[model samples]
Target: MEIVKNRFLKGVTVVLSALLVISLMGCGQKTDAKTTEAKTVSENVKRMPDEMTKVNLGLPSNKNMSYLPFYVALKKGNFQKHNLNVNLSVVQGGVLALRGLQSGDFQIISSLPESVITGASEGANVKLIGTLDIQSMYSIYVAKDIHDPKELKGKVAASMVPGNGTDIQLQYWLKKHGLEPNKDIRIINAGDNAERLQTLQQGQSAVTILSPPTDLKADELGYKRFLMRDELKTYNHNMIAASGDQIKNKPEVIYAFMAAEAEAVTFIKDKANRDEVIKIVMEQMEMKNADAEKSLDFVLPALADHGKINIEGIKWAIDMVKEAGVLKKEINLDKLLDERFYAK
Candidate 1:
């Protein structure tokens, strides 16, 4: 409470200082360039006491490389503009992330809709309110010695925990090649993105799915790109979601957070902001100039159209998950969405 009060006070001081600076500038007294830049930044942050919503945003992934919008919202001060104070926490997998949400530890999770779908079908009552990136950014990487998906047959491969999106993707890809996942190839339980990449690099797994930056790096190091994510023609990838009752009690928080995210999305898609967004990505993902450019090229178009959920993609993903045995009984996506928070 004291911290909030102090921040609110600081915000007020910042605003007042800006007005004074403007007054001085109008009087033909030159303002310091550095001070002007500082004040300009301060005005973009919200400081209202009632609206300083604290959020425990869950990121099951280890890094923000995959969730670029959230990273932009944080780095570019979009969250603060909406008075959202975010505390981001990372766990190993979506299962642990959903567990956190169920136990009241997470206000919202940035994950795959498949994760929320799996959780909701099991009586969890979580729903994806909005999608961030609408398509699966994941591309398949194979060992240097392998050329095609078929070549991976009877080879050691890596998979995410069973019933997750990656698992489903692996199954779908193999079935397309007339191969059963478990019988035709050995899928090891690689822990996370880093683990899977290491498994592939160490020759432990012949094939694995990786999203951008990592996938870009894999390509740089001579791994074969078996397939691209967009080739699937179907995806319901990264999304933002919260529990039903939790959202009901504090709808404003969710709304403000979504608004900030949408703002970031706009910033990401604008051509004028291209250089700035790419610079941020380079710093955040620790990518070189070329890889960062490649990443922005790959993901920007695939970002949700103004952060709206793709009902078609969501439905397709649900059907695929059901076929994979992740969901016992099918449930309508309408029952799994609280559409009030995101831009509809």
Candidate 2:
């Protein structure tokens, strides 16, 4: 009985020792994986220059994923590579951002070319240097109860702000669907997609236009997809504009800034950077990996190339603005766009 007991005890000790070794190995692997990920993130972040040129870039909304390339550039050191120190801020309204640009509060801003067109018409002396999003990700989403587009009649909707990109987008889509905006349904200037989503959830608005992460969330909530915007391919969305004064005084700065943006967009478009860019989308937009991946495939093909504005797309925006009552008379597109910077 003593011999049998000794053998059993020895077997039990060997099994426990083996289990301990396996556990330690697994923990080491997990540590290594985490360290590698951290290293990657650290490597991707660009360090600020000690004596960098200062440029403030304003954004329409902080949460909109349509402007991901700009964030990517900030993360990927494209700005630093181009010898520019871009300080990005939320200017709230596209027109306000443009106003800030003109007043010297902001050096550059990302907005729909229509806003820039309207500003040019209103005598703000701003010019679009580059187009960021050619095929807009903006799509109309309605509440679950309101299934049909016409059902949106007499219902309320939300936008980024009055006469901004999202508002114009909502109006344009409404007109396309045979419903007169403000005549058929009431559209109010709420806020960004994030804020708009909150208002929608609270039943303040039954319909709104949203971008990627917000759009993905709206889908999960079973909101009715009123207008996918896949048909409106001719019109471009976001553009980088500098005040006429900035364009005249510091054309080189505009060129460097635009070049960095172009590099960032190119980097995001590359298949080799797919994993990293998708990771960026997930982190920056606070989305799951699945949603990020889904958005990547949905939005990748729609990005503008070399940060150059499409002449045809600009024309489309001008036409839309004219119809929206933002522009009373025809303005020459040739004079509005500073194509020299983008051409380089």
Candidate 3:
């Protein structure tokens, strides 16, 4: 009787051990399945497409190479890749572009820092979000007869609308050369690139600021080009701005637009994309191969690093605006700039 009891107890203990092993194996399988499921869900979320968003972007001029990054973004589908359908509006001048931005006609505008500073100072709820080009794309072009900067004194200088990028650069250049902007050399809102070139050709203005292909055209017309010094090159010539409402409300849209722009800048800087970039310039600006190549070469170095806004450059622009008498009081950098959307 004792031996039978011992055998039965041993059998019971063996069965219990087997059952426990099976249960542990089942738990391990379940945990493995859950981990796999969780990983797949995370991957699906990452691959999910962003809802398409339409964005109206205002530019001073589409024909100029300064806005090349935007054109590249559009042509290369960078904006669409980021789920942004960006529409371009040629608003003629930065001041008018900002006005369009204020009136709700445009959600964003690319213009000179001066326009932003002046507009923000005058109660326009706008912020400089990013810059397309950090350096000035402009060169002072003079009529065939005028050879010296001093000779430009008392002469009319063709520029875009007052407070435009070209206007600000022209004033800064003139001031640096000991020539006062309005007092010594008269600066007029002559018009866009072609119009300014016509003004110079018609002798309406003795000197005017010209960027790429237009400067090349000026050269062909026997006009002399005066390259600005490195100091003036630091000016934030082409900056992207948005209203306070847009920055506050639709931040995702801003991020998408900036991501596209930054990609475009990267694309432009890559030498492997040289032919493609030139093709874009030709198609957008309506230029020939050689002219487009030359324009691209001229404007390539001016592109901002991943569309990053230059705070020091902004400070310099503010001081320059104050000196230009466009802004009466100082502008707070924090209020005037919102760089959160710019990807490094």
The most accurate candidate by lDDT is 3
Q: Sorted by TM-score, highest first, which candidate order results?
A: 3, 1, 2
- Write the residue-wise lDDT of candidate 3 on 281-330 in tens digits: 88888999998888898888888887887677888888877876779766
- The better candidate by TM-score, 1 or 2, is 1
lDDT of 1 at 16: 100
Question: Sorted by lDDT, highest first, which candidate order results?
Answer: 3, 2, 1
Tell me the spans in candidate 1 whose CA falls farther than 4 Å from its real position. Answer: 1-49
TM-score per prediction, in order, is 0.82, 0.80, 0.82
**Which of 1 and 2 is the better model by lDDT?**
2
Query: Considering only N, C-alpha and C atoms within 3 Å, which residue pairs clash in candidate 1?
Result: none
- Predicted candidate 2 versus true structure: per-residue lDDT over 12-49, tens digit per residue: 99999999999999999999999999999856543333
RMSD of each: 17.9, 21.5, 9.0
- CA lDDT of 149 in candidate 3? 82
lDDT of 2 at 9: 100
Q: Candidate 3's error at 274, in angstroms?
A: 0.5
